[model samples]
Target: MDIEIAFGQPRPWTETVAWGPYRARHADLFEFVMPGVARYTLEDRSRVTVTPEDGADEAPIGEMLVATVLPSLIWARGDVVLHASAIARPGQNAGLMFVGASGSGKSSRLQRAVGRNARVIADDSARVYLQDGELLASGLPGGMFIRTHDAADSRTLVSVPPEQQLKALPVTSMLILGNDDSPVRRLTGVEALASLLRHRHRPRILRLLGTEADFIGPLGDIAARLRIAVVGVRAWMP
Candidate 1:
C-alpha cells in the first residue's frame, strides 16, 4: 500500500471549496471535511487520517478513501494518475486503456471488452508508471463504478467484492475515445501526450505541489514508447 490510513481527530482548517457535504482545503496540508460523514486529513499526502462523523456509515467513507484520497497519495508519491479506465486480456499480463472526457464512453467501451473476457484493470482512474521502460497500470481499490445500464450485464459486475482486486499489468495500447470521422488513427507523440495531460488526475494539484515536472517526465516517456491511437466510430485508424 502506498498510503496508510488511521482514525484520528479532525483538525481545524480553512475551507478551499465548500459544496454540499464536501469542504476541502490544501494549504500546509490537504484536508477534506465531510459533514456528518468523515473528515480526512492527508499529511503531506503521505499519511491519511479518517475521522468518522457521528452516525456515519462505513461504505461511503471507504469509497471516498479509495476513490479520492488514495489517488492524491499516488500523485504525492511521484506517480502519474489519469482519469481513464482499462482492462487486461484474460490470462495475459498486458492491458489496453481507454481515455476521454466524462461521457465519452471510456467506461462503456471497457465494459464491452470486459463482457468479452477482459479483466477489469480500472473503472474511472488508471494508476500508471514506468517500470524498466514499460508503462504499467494497476487496478484502484474499488468496484467498477458504472454509469450506464448496459454495464450491468458484464460478467465482472459483481460489486467489487472486497477481496477481488487486480494487480499491476503492463499497458500495451492506448485509445483516445472521441467522435472523429475515422474508425481509428495513430497519434503522434505530441498528440498522445497532450491527450494524457488533459486526462491527468488532479493536474492542478500537481502544479500546486510543485510536482508537475515529475508527473510529465514519466508521461512523456510512456507516450513516446506506447502504441497510442485515436478511435471513434469514424475515428482515425492506425
Candidate 2:
C-alpha cells in the first residue's frame, strides 16, 4: 500500500493553518474534522490516523478516509488530484478520463463505461502524477460511488475492481465535460491547457499550501500528451 491507515489519537500541530472549523494543516500533517463523524490526520502522504468521535464506527470513517482524506493528502503534495473519473479497456493499461466540475456527470459516464466492460481506474478523484518522463494515474480501487434519487444521497455500484494494490496506469485520452455546442471537439495548445487547469481538485488547498507552482512542471506535459476534448452529455462514442 502506498499509504498506511491507523486508528489512534492524532498528534498536535506545531504550526497550524486553520481555514475553518473543519480544515487545518501543519507541515506535512493535515487534519480533517467531520463533526461527530471522525477526526482524520493525514501525515506526509503515507499514513492516516482515524480517531473516532461521538461513537462513530470504522465504516464511515474509513469511507471518508478514501473520499476526502486521501485526496487532500495527494493535493497537498505537488501532485495533481483531479476532479475526474476514468476507465480503461480490457487488456489496455491506459485510461480515458472524464474531467470537469463536480456533478458534471463524471460518475454517470464512468458507470456507462463500466457497463461496456471497461475497468474503472478511478471513480471520482483521479490521482495523477509525473514519473519516469510520463504522466501516470493510480488505480484507486473501491466501490463506484454515484448519486441516487435524492440529490444528497449516494449509492455504490460494484463492478470488476482493479488490482488489490495501487499501481500506475497511463492516461492517453481525456474528455472535458461541458455544454459546448459541438458534439465533440478536440482541444489544442492554449485551449487544452486552460481546460486542464480548471478541472484539478481543490484549488483552494493548493492556494493554502502554496504548492500551486509545484505542479506547473507536469501540467504542460499532461496537456501536450493527452488527447483532450470537450464533449457534451451522451456525446461519447467509443
Candidate 3:
C-alpha cells in the first residue's frame, strides 16, 4: 500500500528525542513527534500517518521512514515484526531469518552469507507471518543499511535496488545468532517462543495505546509453526 506522507505545520510542543513520556506528546494516543526525525500517528490498528522533520533532506526522512514509520505500519497490519536480518539461497524463493540482540552479528553474518551466494532479504527489520501454514518474510523498499565502514566489503548490500523489496520469501528456518563458537542447536518450542518474543519489535507507543492484546495470539501462533535454532560463527564456517 502506498502511504502518503505530507509535510504538516509543526505541532507546538517541547522538542526532544528521548524515549520517555515527557519527550512524546499525546502519549495516551500512541502518537509521537520526534524533533529532528519524523512525526508518527497511529491512526488506528491499520492506519498510520507520518510527517517528516522540518528542513530535513531526503536521506533522514527516508531513514526514519524505514526505521520508525515502516515498523509502525507493519505492526498495524498485525504482522510479527522482528529485529533481525534475513537471507535466501540464490535462485531460491525461501529464506531463513537470523535474529539476535544488538551487536550480535546478525547483519554481519547475513552479509557473509551474501558473499556465498545468498540474496539479502531484509537487513535490519523484517515482517514475518504465517500464511496458509507457511512462514514468510517481507521487506520494505529501502536497500540494506550498511554502516559506512562496512560498505567496502559488502557484496549485494553495496548496490541494493531502491525499488526492489522482497514481497514474500517463505521462511523455512529461523536462526538466533550469538558470539559463541558452538555449532547449531535446535531450540525447543518454549525456547523458541521466548526468543521470538525477546527479539520482536513493538514500539513503546504500544504501551499506553493498549495494543498488546492484539499481538499475543499471533505471536504464539508463529512460535508454534516455525522451527527455531541457535547458532554461532561455527555454523557459518566453511
Candidate 4:
C-alpha cells in the first residue's frame, strides 16, 4: 500500500520507500528502503541509513521510518506535535505527557515510570488531536532512548537487545518540564492554556489555522476533559 503524506515543505527526495509488503509515499524529508531501514541524505553530501542485521527483526527500522514520517503527517493534519514523553492508564481513563528540551530528563522520567508499571504512551515526540468531545493522546512513530548516569545500570531498565531500545506508547497528559523543586501539580483553565501554548510545537500554526483567537478556549476544554500538568523533578533527594 502506498501512503501519501502531505507536507508543508517540498519533499527533498523523488523516490519511494519500500518495506516488506508495503511501500510508503515519500516526500523530501527521508525514505526507508525496507522494514527497519532508513536513508537520510544531508546537504553535506553524507547519507545515513539505518538497516537491521541479517535475520534480525525489522521492527526497529520500521519504527524509525514511522518516526521520520508521522510528525510531518501530524503537522499537515493541523494537530499539534510536540517533543515530549507521555503515559496513559491501561483503560485510557487518564494520561500524562512531559515536554522539554534535550537533557531535561523527559525520557528518564518516562523510563522511571515504566519501573512503576505506568503504561507508556509515547516517547521522544507525541501527537495530540481532538476526537469527538475529548482530546486524545495517541502514539506516534518514534522510539525512546534511555540515558542513565551509569551506562551499565541503564541496561536493567527497558532492555532491548543490541544496546538500543525503542518502543511506542500512547499519550494522555500534557506536562511541560521546567526546573523546580516544587511537587508535581495539575494546571487548568487559563493556567493550562498558558502552559500548552508556551510549549506548542508551532505557535505560528495556531495563527495560520485561525484558531489563535480561540486557542485558550479549546485548550481549556481539552485540559478540563483530560489531565494536564507541569512537573518538577529534583536531581537530589528532598
Q: Which stretches of candidate 2 lie over 4 Å from their true place?
A: 21-25, 57-59, 157-159, 162-166, 179-181
TM-score of 2: 0.86
TM-score, per-candidate, Cα-based: 0.78, 0.86, 0.78, 0.54
User: Over the stretch 194-235, how does candidate 3's per-residue lDDT look in tens digits?
Assistant: 887788765554443446677777777788777788888567
Residue-by-residue lDDT tens digits, candidate 4, 96-202 = 77776656667667766665555665666566667665566655423456755676334222432221222333335566676776677878777876776676554
Ranking of models by TM-score: 2, 3, 1, 4
Highest TM-score against the true fold, candidate: 2
Q: Give per-residue lDDT, candidate 3, residue 154.
A: 36
> What Cα-based lDDT does every candidate model obtain?
0.70, 0.72, 0.65, 0.51
Shift of residue 131 alpha carbon in model 1, Å: 1.7
Model 4, 29: alpha-carbon shift in Å? Answer: 11
In terms of lDDT, the poorest run of 10 residues in model 3 is 21-30
Ranking by lDDT: 2, 1, 3, 4
Minimal lDDT window, size 10, model 1 = 153-162
